[model samples]
Target: MSWIKTRLKSFGYAFNGLWTLFRTETHAQIHLLALVVVTVAGLITGLERWEWLAIILTIALVVAAEGMNTALEALSDALHPGHHPLVGKAKDVAAGAVLFCAIAALAVALIVFLPHWL
Candidate 1:
């Protein structure tokens, strides 16, 4: 009972957070859309197992980063409650991480999709 309780305490918070985010975060919904598309594309394209793994992992990474960015922005807004340059910069930086991951995913997509289509 003690061990199970500890494990749940450690991980359960994340699930609750994800559920809340799914309900409220528009970006989370966008990620869900990208996730479905990327997964279907992988299956249709017949990527090798490793390529499929890479594509799936990359998409998860993108969504995970985006989710974290959304969380930070929410928390930041709560903490600041006013427009400040530093707060704005922090949000921008968090968003930039999402952008970087998205660009990387697009590159992976090009590698995966271009040869088949062209």
Candidate 2:
């Protein structure tokens, strides 16, 4: 394939993965709802450019963390259909990473929005 075609195919795969994540993952759906709420709040509050950048980056961080966690869980399940302690540990770690990212995202949101509300 040409370089452009290869890049396009890669993007298509990424989009398909994103669709699967949002369609089948409850956590992803919740994140989507949160994203919508944050977007509306930002618009209503009229965020400055830097505030919008922080919000956008934080949202991306959360989504990427969630996606990585889902991917790890799916792979673990497929590789070891039976319960295994190490696999469980790995999955837990991945989930913990997502939780950490989520907490950080919440902090960023509060820092960006609290002043506006106040």
Tell me how candidate 2 scores on lDDT: 0.95
Q: What TM-score would every model get versus the actual structure? A: 0.88, 0.97
Q: Model 1: per-residue lDDT, tens digit, 21-100? A: 77788877877787788788777877788788778888878878988898889889999999999999999999999999
In candidate 2 the C-alpha lDDT for residue 116 amounts to: 93
| Whole-model Cα lDDT of every candidate shown, in order | 0.85, 0.95
Tens-place lDDT per residue, model 2, 1-118, is 6999999999999999999999999999999999999999999999999999999999999999999999999999999999999999999999999999999999999999999999
lDDT of 2 at 113: 97
Candidate 1: C-alpha lDDT: 0.85
Residue pairs whose backbone atoms clash in candidate 2: none
Best by TM-score: 2
